[model samples]
Target: MTTHVQLHDRLDYQSVAPLMAELTAIADDMLVIDAGNVRHLGTLPLQVLLSAVRTRAAQGKITRLAHASDNCIDMLGLFGFTPETLTQPEAWT
Candidate 1:
């Protein structure tokens, strides 16, 4: 089963640590991130996200971003992540 992480609006440095901890604790085969409410993206949070996504892929697990907000998508794009690419883990390599 997939573990769902509900993202918030402020994913800044103040929140990244806890968020990263939550993400790292998931033991499911798939991780589903609900980014619909993400309005701000900070460098730390973005790094944490990229690490989680890449780590999951390296382990042959899935990391999915479902219903991401426009702001979230734009911020992720800066790091080379498109909605299509998010689904294709190999593209992240």
Candidate 2:
């Protein structure tokens, strides 16, 4: 089953650790992260997301992003992540 994770509006450095912990708990399942309400994006949270992706991949699972706001998309792009890369099932490996 796929679990939908609703991300917070502001994903700054302070929020990364908690988010990472939460995501890590569910890393064994397929995750679809909803970013529609994200108004801010920070590098720390981006790293958390990347780590979640890798964790899921290690378990032969997948993590995908959905409803990403322009800010989220732009920030991810700045970090060299495209929409396709974020959602591609094969990208994790």
Identify the candidate with maximal lDDT. 1
Clashing pairs in 1: none
Which ranges of candidate 2 are over 4 A from the true structure? 87-93
Q: What TM-score does candidate 1 get on C-alpha atoms?
A: 0.87
Can you give the lDDT of residue 53 in candidate 2? 81
What overall lDDT, based on C-alpha atoms, would model 2 receive against the true structure?
0.82
Q: What is the C-alpha lDDT of each candidate?
A: 0.85, 0.82
Q: Per-residue alpha-carbon lDDT of model 2 for 30-74, expressed as tens digits?
A: 889999998888988888888778768778887788999998889
